[model samples]
Target: MPVPPPPADLTTIAHALQERLGPARWFDAHTHIGQHDPDGMTATAEEILAGLDHAGHERALTFAMHEPDGYRQANDVVLEASRASDGRLLPLARIAPGAPGALEEARRCLDAGALGFKLHPRSDAFALTHPDVDAVVALAAERRGPVLFHAGRGIPQLSEAAVALAERHPGARLILAHAAVSDLGLLAEPAARLPNLFFDTSWWHPSDLLQLFATVPPGQILYASDMPYGPGTFSAFAFLRCCAAVGIPDDAVREMVGAQLDRVVTGADPVDLGRAVGSARLGERSLPLERVASYTAVAMQLGYRGVDATEAVALARCGAQTTGTGPEAELLRYVDGLLARAEERLAAAADDDAPARMAAVLDAVVAGFLAATTSAGVPPVAL
Candidate 1:
């Protein structure tokens, strides 16, 4: 197979990690593929397929992006795309749990070949306290299909209700997307006890991923790329590196990457991969990379909030410009190369809003951050 390209190139780093990790099938448990999202993000089925191919993934479970005007049409679009994807794309009905006919819509899509359901309480503006949420989760439970919840950002503390639903319907495969960072600190302990509750690794940020792997059972963590938000190639790169950093065995890494998600979506019971690997297993740390992660995280957040991230980006640049030599310095210089590329893209943007350009900058920051993550294990060859 041909090697995928850089600036967030995976060849050198992934080669080492994959050699150690052995072979594993990748099932991307979370992805968004659509043309019209109110958020200005668009990903066609072809784009998602290319990403899966680039990452050497077998298939991806996808739903519509934020469809504010109801998801009936959006759901249909996804279903049609999946039907033609030759098993490479799996469609999930994006639903507003509180909306009228939500259950009916879910039933329709499920009967029409949807693998599961996607609920974004923040985007849909439901509190999860809505009476319909339980009904929807119960439906998933009855069908043995996975019910993925948006746990990235926004929204209030929702684990209480989620816990209640998971307990009530033992079969409901509950997935908290985006590393479940909204409540990761609070849910780590609870997640250990709830076998059916899972988290999707669809985020950037090394420490956040480090924490998730250290706290949650590997069985409950699934590989996912928020496609269009983040590409599968980078996700696979960072994920494998983190797994190696935490001293997680290749067997557990195999399940975390894809095996377990396949079972959940197919309405099959999930396999137990034993307990979490303690943080002690996390090998040597690089303060430089840690600072690089910090600055990039801030820059990306500022960009998302529609604020100028120039200062943060500059700080990130500074963080990546380490002096002297060795592993830490070498890694910083590699990330610095990627960061410079992001700045170049940002500088070339002359549009007033520069939405597309801004996305490019932020996406570059994500790439730089994740590329830094690979430094946690084997020092990545300079790109």
Candidate 2:
């Protein structure tokens, strides 16, 4: 089957910028390939590879989903699968910080050829300050590897512990996944001092990402898709749109795509993309995109909360009815089409409760944010 091109408006935008930026090898800094997630999300290595092909990404940093039973077997599954991917997949062992033998398992996986580690404070039911966590992170520092944390949700005390851990282990590349939304303001402040600390762009909303891009060093922001939960192509489109919104230089955006990750995976220090310009003075807004952004936020919130978003989607379409004719409005038109398609998909789905239908809704939400970003072409600060 032919791989579909990215959404047309986004593709058009990339084409226009390619002249100055040239092409970049995008690396998805966060992803998963496993079947035993308690949350009912499963993704195969094949699916991730296909997603990479579709998104024009060159490689990915993949690990297992949450393994409540034990991560030893799941870690092996990831290592074995990544071994066969011919460099397209770089394996990261998932460690449950509270689990017994957690430090041993981290060592075992790294010795078994895994590149880094992933820890989920929310799912693993442990905090970063756990006694065993320092041991694992210390091992990562010794090996000069990455230790990616799930910062997707707000967890109590995680921010302070994470800052302390980064300060302690400058050798380990500590990546706070999902835009580090839990403590973007606080973390962004000290991120400049902690050269080893980083953030990955993997969350679903634009508001969080806007602040991340605005307030964090571009060098410290790695492009991530959080595959299985978020499709690679869709997330990549959002990345491109956000990059354009901030008006960063072509070279810096190129680095964010993959080049920077190439270094991070090896546990090497990141190349400087300069300091962030404070988020307080972020410039530009499009009324049309503003409507779409509001709709997107509400829709994602409802969907994730297990609420039906049909009424919200319908109400959103009402506001998008009159976007005039420019680049921003043009993207809004694309967003409107995606929303209509989502409605049609929802209507036609055999099982209304199926994951596909839920994914359809998310697709439109992400597209809405992508469109919203088109208006802020001259991002207030360069870094």
Candidate 3:
């Protein structure tokens, strides 16, 4: 089938920017393509790929969304897309934090060719910094994969919480969606500090993006279009134009589009490649649970109060209190005990009406401990 071209204006935007910024091919960092009906997004994998080809993007990290039980449907659509694209669409599996068989499902997705895990805290009613986040992170790391987290500071959102959670997982590479726009002035400090941290530009206004562009290194910035949420090609082309308009170099734009994201999608650590992306932050800093708790308090006030939010806050605090220096065995035991308790809670909730809520809380607590332990000098990947 012949792929469609973008709108004339969009093509112009890309060409104009390429002329100025030098022609560096781009890789879209984020995208969601699917068909939705009562049966969830019913689009075939080929249709989604057709859209990608039509967009003129070299590659993309494709994801999907639907209600709770729609994981299967969504996964099927994405898996098909991944297979058809032959790696152009890096299929990512979306799993509600508290869904039954969530971990098992993640494994299944990876086996079926998902490149990473896709988490939407807002829609799933959980926070990235939730305690159980470690389990998912651990699973991804075990597979030598990365995780892309949806981040934004709006209704039912927890962009701030998601960033905080990434801080805890040093070994788990994180893709922060929308780059928390709250503190534009200080965003670079955090971006430069987190070695495994990456950001995607999808919906921010030209001004906000320019502000971010001035501070954040291009290697950390990914060109993304949260399709179905944004104006698709129009929005993506506008972002590219804005990047060029802001005087960002052409090579930088290329890096933003795909060079950097390609590394993350392929799970290639810059450090391993001797790229020196950045030194790990929170290394010398004591990321006590108190700091996380303080943020959670403010977050709750801002309406971040869901099962995942509350549980992550509590677990971070508890993790800070429980684990301390001693024999390595002792530390491991302590963590094991904490995880065991979490499992008990999860087991108990299996038959509960609100299994997702209960599971989210448990996962949040685990993620909290993992973050806290990392702050105390443990590798975020240790979990």
Candidate 4:
């Protein structure tokens, strides 16, 4: 394939973004930050802030998992990180509907300066569409804060009903995290009918962003990086490129993607870390490209491999290419080549074992790209 000329003054765009926003103030709409697994990115409060800073995020609103063994500890960690960032971090608390102190804890999170609540029906063990879940939404409405929910396929009906609840409460904010292309179709009705509903862009394919911009209003969108879930900041950068590609002008990108998150960032009050749990934060003492690689390797173990991951990472590195030549460009070509190879492999892999092997190879290719691109700090090419 013939290489297209590089986008005009891409370096100037990066420099402008770095200067204007001081690392682009990404409000990570949904991240499992408070989980204290020793194997996870699992770092201290100070470490989480430094990592966010290094990743170019000004702030992130994090949520705790709703499972028992460590639920309260997770909330404690999110609280601590929010405090340590001096409001640069926004905390989102988790409430498993039937948990012993679910309601009381959610209310306390509001009092403790949590910006919102996050509900994961699969992990939390309840339907977001359930009557009990309605009480949670009502509480958020009563408190004047937002609620973020997991919305996607093969999950419970709560994702849809949650939209209905948001429609019912116009004053309350309802964020659909990881708004996929399928989600765009699912959310269109409720979002169009309801002004308070918002969508978060995290670890999604770049194509989904294009679909969304063509369909939804710019103001209804928000930028997020599911950090240390880690493709590094490439996830956020891809969103920017997608916005730019779709003729969502730079100012609008900065406004809806950057400034809107910044507005949410500034509203956060720090958690009192002295009394909060320390285990829920990222354990990194400092930022290192290797740390990012290590964390992403875990996601690899989680069986989340896909061709889009490689393409998205490649596109990000392309955007960061200042000279439009050198190794970054070479890597872009490699990714393009790999996609061609993957398609061929997919077709030829008639046996189950062959398909699995091909998928594993693709996953490794993605991992290698992620490691190299992040270390280089080169933005990705627009797909």
The best candidate in terms of TM-score: 2
Displacement of residue 347 (Cα, Å) in model 4 is: 23
Q: What digit string (tens of lDDT, one per residue) describes model 3 on residues 195-221?
A: 676767865344355555556666777
TM-score of each: 0.88, 0.89, 0.62, 0.65
RMSD of 2: 4.4
lDDT tens digits by residue: candidate 1, 1-383: 11113233344554555566778888998888777677777888888888787677889999998877889999999999999999888899998987889999989998999877999998889987787888888888888889999997775867787788888988889999988888888887888898989999988777788888888888999998888776677677778877766777888889888889889998888899988887876556666666767887877777666666667767777877666787666666777776776676566655555454555455455545554455353344555
The regions of model 3 sitting more than 4 angstroms off are 1-7, 37-44, 155-160, 182-186, 271-383
What is the clash count for each candidate, in the order shown? Answer: 0, 0, 15, 18
Task: Assess each prediction's global lDDT (C-alpha) against the native.
Answer: 0.77, 0.77, 0.55, 0.53
Q: Pick the winner on lDDT between candidates 2 and 3.
A: 2
Compared with the true structure, the alpha-carbon lDDT of candidate 4 equals 0.53
Off by over 4 Å in 4: 1-24, 35-44, 180-182, 262-383
Evaluation by lDDT, superior candidate among 2 and 4: 2
**Local lDDT at 6 for model 1:** 26
Residue 316 miss distance in model 1 (angstroms): 2.6
